[model samples]
Target: MKPVDSPERTKNRTRSGRRGGESTTRTDILTAARHLFGENGFTKTSMRSIATEAGVDVALVSYHFGSKRGLFTAVMEVPGDPISRVTAAASGPRSDLGRRLITTFTSIWENDDMGVALQAMLRSAVNDDGAAKAFGDFASGEMMPALAKTAGLSQETVRAIGSCVFGLALMRYLIRAESFTSLTVDELVDQFGPKIQAIVDQGR
Candidate 1:
């Protein structure tokens, strides 16, 4: 029999070749889901397809993630409580808000596991409005309110700030689509952090 070199099959084989154990099962599922979501976009990628790619039963995937949306959330896993971090930085006496904000974002996106997770999540957001809405909902419910509290901005201003940060997150870490990707997190902090902080400082 001839081997099939189709993208799905090839990707499935690549995913399956990794060591087996239930401990790694969730990670494996996430890895496969990320690849699919990144390449095919969220709407096109299905839970069953993810299971097939991972060489696991559909039930297993369903068991772990519960639904396609849930799987996407798992696949796009951003490290740490993004809400808490942003709010904490925003709340601190209005001094060096940019530095704190930059440092916090840097810490989350620079780490290997979190970086991949966050990148995967952003890719979904780029390709799926539902995913984008989910991200917005998170910011609106958790991150924005806290930011508003600390920055003394109205909800509209907070939303705008969230939009800017979301754009930065997508462009820099998720797509890595430009010269910006080459810059170290510290360099990014120095360059972009102050600008972000300025926005919060003005609090318009």
Candidate 2:
């Protein structure tokens, strides 16, 4: 698959200048993008589709947003402090760490706008090498460390626990993977909690 440009790379590349009905046009595009992104996700939703939805020329999307990723960033930005939430999840009794963390992670996606942000981020990472490396760095250097610090475990251990859990968010929400999506949150906790606790217990 061809890589899409990261939002930062194309941030300054937008075509500028006011056109007739520019405000309305931009609003239209944003409205269309929001709908398509919510319904089809970042990867499946195309600039042309957004344009079609907005009844605008495809070039207008590039003119205003720079690229598909740029549009996603502008419109589908994720909200809340995930790192803080992770820290909170890791607090208290460490015995139920797996269940606590899994519940918090799933709540972020299922209950709010964070799901859209994560979906876009995941799709972008899959489609763009730069996005993958950029997010990977944050996951390794930042987010995982918070969980490690709070849980009294090494980053490697937290990552191992995360590796066992985070994928289910993608499978259930993003990929809509069979069987995986069919399971309830409690079912996921029942299945993944033990594996995550196993890693945590190893303390490696």
Best by lDDT: 2
Model 2 residue 63 CA deviation in Å? 27
- Per-residue lDDT tens digits for candidate 2, residues 1-204, read 989988876764554522347788888998888777666555567899999999899999999988775675566355655567889989988788877877787777776567777787788767866556545655665578888887899877877777766677667877899889888878877888777777878885
Residue-wise lDDT of candidate 1 within 79-163, one digit each (tens)?
5566567777776666577677778777877788887788777787778875666565555555677778776777876766667
The window of 10 residues in a row where model 2 has the poorest summed lDDT is 11-20
Q: How much does candidate 1 score in TM-score?
A: 0.59
Stretches of candidate 2 exceeding 4 Å from the true structure: 1-76
* Model 2 Cα shift for residue 27 (angstroms): 15
Q: What TM-score against the true fold does each predicted structure earn? A: 0.59, 0.61
How does each model score on lDDT? Answer: 0.73, 0.75
After superposition, the stretches of candidate 1 with alpha carbons farther than 4 Å from their true spots are 1-76
